[model samples]
Target: MSEQFERLSRLPLRDDLRGKHPYGAPQLDVPILLNVNENTYGVPDDVRQAIVEAVSREVVGLNRYPDREFTELRTNLARYLGHGLTPENLWAANGSNEVLQHLLQAFGGPGRSAIGFPPTYSMYPLLASSTGTRYIAGRGNEKFDLNAEDAAREVRQSGANLVFLCSPNNPSGSALGLDVVEAVYEASEDAQAIVIVDEAYAEFAHSGTVSALSLLAGRERLVVSRTMSKAFAMAGTRLGYLASAPEVADALRLVRLPYHLSAITQAAANAALTHSDLLLANVENIKVQRDRIVAGLLQLGLTPVPSDANFVLFGGLDDPHRIWQGLLDGGVLIRDVGIPGHLRVTAGTETETTVFLETLGALLERAVS
Candidate 1:
């Protein structure tokens, strides 16, 4: 008989991701990059100094493991979140990405299902599949609005164990209103499923948008995942925290490896918290830039989605890929969302935005001619 290993090797991998890269658009070495939605600013000098100071004191044993519980970091995070954080109610991961994975490990797996709304973050389904969970998508309304009723119906019918919602949703830059989010939360409550509001872009949204934390009061099953990647400008540091009820937080901790965060990373994140004022200042700048860019796009005859986040999405170009390439060749790089004729551009510095607009103008002129 043929070797049993031969059959195992031939078996197909997960069907959900027949052919897909885990992430979109590899980072290229280009000037004026407005892709990936990173904060266009760098960590403030004061914050950098704090990082240097935190690690400057040499410990007795360099080989000793970091605090597995990350008590100090958790405390700082709790303080940062203002109301929802407690030592018992929060956890940190290598990144929000890892936090999401841990969630999948805990609540998702073979035979269980997770629901996401698309044209949202691409990672949700990918994470679900990697953990052997079935992934279901509820298409958004024509204007990319969250159809919470439809999503709730899907969850009820599919018995999904988790529901992921991204506020100021990725790619589209449209935020779900409070009523809609609350409706979904209420719907998921009976299913005993978790509702995760990924607030990666929350800091940039204008005030009064519904933060998941607002609804978290007394709600044990809701989780809000946040990252230092955007407003804090700490993406490379890979520090993210989740706010939830102590029990849910404990569940996440159980699934994560001990000491998942590095001493240096924890130090960096701690420093980031202290200088949040500086970060908020940058956020204000980005908001102004975002508005200016949106106005410019509208004036150019492109229809930009109303955005409360740090980026904007626009359509009406004949071929978005060609326009993206043209902008790239012109030394301005923006993301070509796979959605037909749409592109997402992150807010950058005034100078970079100026160059981007000029380049985009020339490209549109060429296309029109």
Candidate 2:
């Protein structure tokens, strides 16, 4: 082999992910997929038409590179947010995942640390590790509620430069209290650390909880990340956004790739924003289905976490893997949360939910016998 090839083979990658794949969950061909928390509904016809129109209008511009700054999309997004957001306070990326990665690169690095609340999103720790920052987890309370006091103490102790919180948290579907989030924000102030609230499911929880954006009046270090992937039925489109103070937005821009978002994606996202009301209606339907599922699980002697998101988590099954496999064999796929004895099931259409519950009933009866 050539000397260059030999040198490449000799270099070892970072120890944090020596032999790891970044993404979780394997892809499977199934009739009904309730595993990944995707909105079961398809995009509305009006939104689809708008996207077509947007793409048609932008076709002429394809010969040249897209707007590196994504000016129009940023301005439109800021206006849509309607809570003190301006173009200067907005940033867009391939997805919220990418926005998160930019934040890590901007605020986390060698000799620095970031804090995460466990049984939350799995990506936070992975992102922190990838950026060469120390990742620490503070366990959530009994109800899966974030312990703000403990979080603040740990951040102060570790001198962490970033803290990540996910409302309507993944796998558990519990929304963190606004007061707790604000407390953590205040505690991180002295350390000059950034507080990121991932509001990926905010639309689903719109009826009750206050968004982190609503609490961003004087907080310069707080950043709120949202995605169109959840309630908007556009996970395949890959559009995510961040709302923050202008200074923090500037920091994210500095670390993100130039032209990180494509013109096509920007157009699709803008189109989707215009049809948010229609999307919310779909969310309402999913919420109804979620409630039904939760009640059904309880009847089967399972305890489900109270959820505001479009998914539910339940306990009582001894081996979740067996239940997961049984559901798959019955043509319904649900998520096997890493937490032993617990499983997460995303809300599908009314009919799909019915099929899932019927299948699960049969499986549980067999297990009991």
Q: Which is the leading candidate under lDDT? A: 2
TM-score of 2: 0.94
Task: Name the weakest run of 10 consecutive residues (lDDT summed) in model 2.
Answer: 1-10
- lDDT string, candidate 1, 109-195, tens digits: 998889988888888988988889889886655578777687667666756789898888898888887677677777877678988
Provide the TM-score for each candidate, comma-separated.
0.93, 0.94
Model 1: residue 261 alpha-carbon error in angstroms: 1.0
Misplaced by over 4 Å in model 1 are: 1-20, 58-61
